[model samples]
Target: MLSTAARQAHILAKSRVPAANFGLAARRFASSQVQNEASKEDKATAVPSPEDLAKASHLPHISNVEMPNKDINLKNKLEKPDYEKEGYQVPEWKKAFGETFVSLFHIDMDNVRAGTIGGSKYYYMCKDQGLQFTDEELSETAVFWYDTLGLPRTFAMWFQITTLHVWLLFVRMRAMPFKMGKNYQQKLVDKLFKDIEMRLSEEMNVLSGQIRDSYMKDFHSQMLGMIFSLDEAFAQKSDDVLAAAVWRNVFNGDKNIDIVKLEAVVRYIRMQLYVLDSISDRAFGFGDFEFVGPNETVDLLTAEDKAQLLKMTKMKFEPEDGKTLPSQKSKLSLDE
Candidate 1:
């Protein structure tokens, strides 16, 4: 009923109210969306305080934690001496003369030095002792190694066997009194290493200095690993553990290793260790020890049988009614 201009103005006014309401509604929705996103971000990055973190179910209990002692003195207290400090000092003149004599003959000084204990009458006693395995014993063991483990009679095989025997002796040596045990162990280890070095150059013709050095480093690392494996196995006193160690280190982790042969080796080791354990310390140190013959069944031997075998194998140290024979001391003096 109004004029056209008034009618148009009224419609425009009504349209403005709806548009403003729509804008308000849109702003509210947008604000709600922004708030929801902010809440999510807050939840995602939330960091709890120390007290709250302690109360969290996923964390380990603080009281159950064990911390290592950081004190140097405490750490040092666990270390043991590797050798005797006393009774190893020689006269300067004698030491000089011995060194000269050793050098002149192209003798490996390391072996001599390791075996020497001040003025000990029996220098190179460890080398002279020479593993104490009889020819037959050696041959039989070699056959077993070759046949059972498929090891060829190469230097590598020799090294493994020699290391194995040395490890057995080392185990026995550890049972000795601390100073004596350490001295014997060091001497034997030194001799073994020096001999291996010599064989590499002489027999194996590994003449390159660099190559020899690299091989020696590898050998040292292998020795450490073997020692750790053996120690762990022996400590556990489990046949399965020992067999696994032997298979891994000695057999080079052969996938088709004969379980029976491996068991035989374990038994052999136990038997040898037993025999060595029964020997007198003096005999062991003086190089009078001998291994059981290869034909001898170590595992089958009863305690009485072992006692009798020990008696038979016992080395006679009597020098024909106390007659004074020329000792290593006399020989060294003669060389000088």
Candidate 2:
């Protein structure tokens, strides 16, 4: 039996499909060859060890964060913020000028990720963690889901893991002020499906548009169901409830799942929400939110630190002379 590290390396190598770059004619030819290679590799690989079955974030690669004591209930650790009550106001000047600038340049601050190369900033935030990985690279968050949690590296598994992160972000976005939050959610969802479609065609080699459309429909339904369950758990504001939701969806109801691993996931979700809650509307609107690493900790921001951050933001966006070009004109505040 291979060690956890060796197993991951072997699995990644065997399953690693070369990114599709060939024309339609070439891709049709390469698909069978790729499948044959995968089959050969499958026959050559060894089964995972019993230790692997028992493990979840038990290894050093999983995270530096220590697991909770068996007696400790994670329910007390979860924090749910009331975004409606705590929501910040968007200034009229900012809206009027921001809209004018957007009309001229076709940039919507509310959905700035749409302006990004591959979709919204939020898309990358959700993706980089787990959904997207290559033969040569596995993201830190990917390690957490795949290595730490001992999940299979199939496309369906990827979707399950990615959906969990996306749902967590949705929690934050839904808590945001209505109009802006809705726009952000729509843009992120649009980009997510767009990428999924592309991957189905290019990465998964589903050349049939009809088949891909069916998969999309199925995925859309799953996404909605996952969101509904997660939202209900979140509303309940109990870590145990949230963990059960994670177990049902992300872990796929694995009866053998380690309780410590479940607790880690719950802890991770709460930490992310806490960070999102800490961010201001202006900062997040401008694409400032990032997932903290599973092994890392975020210190509470002090009043002086926030003041300095705002000062720096203003220096970067606003000019000293106050004479801005029409294309560059923006009334979005550096401080919100």
Candidate 3:
């Protein structure tokens, strides 16, 4: 048998135990990454490839990709977004359909109509950087470990949960006006917003067609059931399939879009499509959003319907019309 030194040498060949491969630490790191990647590739409701979509009438619909606690840091990529002009050889409606979807955040769509810095640049930056699902999510992660989880605002900071914890002092004891403070939470939100931009852009471009056809025009019955069933666990697939499709299209040289701009353009459109999807979803169902049906291109879920209808029973009420409202025992009441 090999002596202890020889055995140690064999294990070292795998890499230093203290450095690279450390049992469960390695597994957690590796498996978490695999989970993120695999989840992205295998859609709970997989969107068909463009080739498949062209040939099949009944392609599996786009399902939601759920969120996970931790994720992988995909390689950093830098690219712009893409959009079609009127004269492109592809069907106008197909292109139009692709372009028409909206986003969930209704910040100010009109503010960023084009794919410029003020518009979709944010998405491009995150997508290319491969930013994480969010900052809190990103810190443990990060595309390049350099970009937009951008260096912290301060070289020094702290997390204070309780006074006792503070006294234990993981952070510096000094509190001076001359130094930067710890705003990990806001920094986190800002970073998360960047990630959101990347995800939106990538998804918009990948599933642009679906966004226009199923989501923007209106939420269909299939989407409703699929989305209704999806918790955070299955939502990323929706983003992945869409993102994959966009990459496929962009790679094929189908549009005049700048390769660098693809991410930004996609991010911008994704944000827009998300809002439209939310509006459409809220139309037929309760809560902030809903999934009405399979992507059949319906318009039943309009903004008007959403604003007017509160309950599935078709109950309607003026803002302050409490007398006509359901009782305190009402299960669907938002007040509850």
- Give the better candidate number (1 or 3) by TM-score: 1
For candidate 2, report its TM-score: 0.62
Better of 2 and 3 by TM-score: 2
Cα displacement (Å) at residue 161, model 3: 36
TM-score of 1: 0.51
Residues 158-189, candidate 1: write the lDDT tens digits: 56666676676677667655665676677677
Best by lDDT: 2
Q: Which one wins on TM-score? A: 2
Residue-level lDDT of model 2, residues 4-54, one tens digit each, is: 211112212332232221222222333434564445665365322222323
Residue 248 error, candidate 1, Å: 0.7
Error of 3 at 279 (Å): 4.3
| Candidate RMSDs in order | 36.3, 18.8, 26.6
Stretch of 10 with least lDDT, candidate 3? 155-164
Name the runs in model 3 displaced over 4 angstroms: 1-287, 290-296, 302-336
Question: How high is the lDDT of residue 178 in model 3?
Answer: 13
